[model samples]
Target: MKIPFSPPYINEAVIQEVNSALESGWITTGPKVKRLEELVCKYTLAPNTLCVNSATSGLMLALKWYGIGEGDEVIIPAYTYAATALAVIHVGATPVMVDVEKDFNIATHEIEKVITKKTKAIIPVDIAGWPCNYSDIYAIINKKKELFIPKHENQEKLGRVLVISDSAHSIGATYKSEYLGKITDITVFSFHAVKNVTTAEGGAVCINLPEPFKNQDEYNYLRCFSLNGQTKDAFTKSKAGDWRYDIIYPGLKMNMPDILAAIGVAQLPEYFEKTLQNRVEIYEYYHTFFKTKSWAILPPYKSDDKTSSCHLYALRIKDISESERDAIIDKISKEGVAVNVHFQPLPMLSLFKEMGFDIDNYPVAYNNYKSEISLPIYPQLTKNELEYIVSTVTNAVESSL
Candidate 1:
């Protein structure tokens, strides 16, 4: 009856694809990587895409691409993983941590309060597979356009604030009937082991910037930039008499290798149907079981205009103290059931604490974090195991209370 947390869904097809890529001579940023990018563009409907090593790399690259640097400010949710805010910090920009709504996405109401002339970008995180309210975010940014200061070339080109989505958990999610990458100005998707769709350790960036910046041109630049700004990659460099290459800029080494990309290519065909559907069923059952209990507060899975990828089942035990929540987790662990917390508010972390961000300032984020418990849900989970989990969780919470 042992239950583990999230695990990668690796099938024989995925294995064979990776094995075939290994058998193939080219591996780094080759045909397979290109295919994954193409598939992502088709799936997300993003005009341009660049496959990178990780979502953190993608986010940092986007911040750098937009010329967000020292003295600039980027807003992000306090409730997300450290990578979201760390990306802003890596770009030398000040990250303005904001609160999140109960759905675990950035609080749109809190965004306006932090808006300033120095605000150059806002990285809205779509946590737990739920897409952020992009329509609301866009409206807020559009309303405050006049107040936004364009400090760099990329900034001046758009003459407005950039919207970069931290979409690591929400690749297949939809907002207003549109996929995540298309909803924001730019979106970053992670393919880490625990994600719904994994490429071992990879991610991609989707560019949906304003006019005057053709997506292909941006994509080409990003491709070169990611490979240490080399004009030609090893693939092209291998061709006869094409040995020489030039560095366009001092850039990052974050390109995805073809071996990893092969897994993604194998995953794309059945991602929305089989894998995501499995997590969705897990979410539904959790809701069905927890709804009978008055202590249960379920995460939002769907709405008239949106649908989740159903990545994490972030359940909240209402009217409980943080200590009680911890106790419940301990009780569950004793029964061989594994669980986790989505995140502690950024301010609660040491780095942010030193930066002088107090968790008390974000009351809503703190409230959500204190009671939140993430349940295990993956495609391989069986019906009997799922039933055991629900019952175990129910007993754990009630007994702890």
Candidate 2:
């Protein structure tokens, strides 16, 4: 029984929604996209949300909206998807890579060391669906606001160095009793096919800022920025008598289409409990099996104040070289049971190396990357298929020794 990594769980609802969009003729970023954005905002309990083409775009827009650019720096976990750091660079800001904690999420304690005069923001990623220590991050940000970059004399008084979260893997995760989207200044969610909740190819940014930035009416302005930084979106300009609009800024085209949002809106109703429950069951199955293995170090599950979204199940084999990890993956694939690695630390990748980052400097991230392996935990896996996966992993591990 060949068990693949993560086959998207699509049903008739998704297909019908797409068919409806195709039939509507207004399949671009139109009414359906607006409805999806509303659903996302309601689900995340966020004051505002903007749907975009991808999570990378969501992160880039967040950084741009916060005015982080040249002469500024943003701290990020070295262990996250490259998209996290790449978004920082996309906005012309320096990405200060920091080591993660033993659990493999961003180390909240280390954020203070990297804080400097140029530090404009801190982007703590919720790697593998486990929420970062947002309370600690919030405490640190409030206590150390003096270390952040000073506000421009002309610009409005900025809030504390913006706490943007790369919550790509944590749509349903909670930190300190609040959902991920509400726990930070800004949070980005990826609805990629393999994610916990999928929209085929889509993402959303949830804004939880205080005061003047909290205007509910600004959602249209955000949609405009996503379209092309224009004063009016294509939807408004397409009206019978309103075709004129002005460019507000040099923005990029990354808006989510109603075609994609159709899937999103259909999938959202099943997100909170049903989909999450299936993922959790898979997670628990893996945990029950691997916890007894002496060489297998499991990822974090429980925390003092957080609950995971049960995203990626990253397992580390103790005392193994990076080559050994690769060999294990090869062995597993050979058994017709597909598996994958979560990420290679950004600094180890050539793009980052060219940008003057050294992998050796981030010892913890390198260590985590070398020892880690991600198992398939999607909802579609049957009980028998899961058993095969577990047996295959067990055989591969014992054989590797």
Candidates in order, TM-scores: namely: 0.98, 0.96
The TM-score, computed over Cα atoms with residue i paired to residue i, of candidate 1 is: 0.98
Please provide, for model 1 over 1-401, each residue's C-alpha lDDT reduced to its tens digit, 9 standing for 90 to 100: 89898878889999999999999988888999999998999988999899999999999999988898999999999999999999999889999988888888899999999999999999998889898888899899999999977778888888888999999999889988888888888999999989988999999999998788788888888888899999998888998999999998888898999999999999977786578787888899998989899999999989999999898999999988899999999999898889999989999999999999999998889999999999999989999999999889999988887
Whole-model lDDT values for every prediction: 0.91, 0.85
Can you give the lDDT of residue 47 in candidate 2?
83
Off by over 4 Å in 1: none
Q: Worst 10-residue stretch by lDDT in candidate 1?
A: 268-277
C-alpha RMSD (angstroms) for model 2: 1.6
Write down the lDDT that model 2 would get.
0.85
Q: Which pairs clash in the backbone of model 2? A: none
Candidate 2 local lDDT, 72-101, one digit each (tens): 999999898889998999999999988998
| Best candidate (score: TM-score) | 1
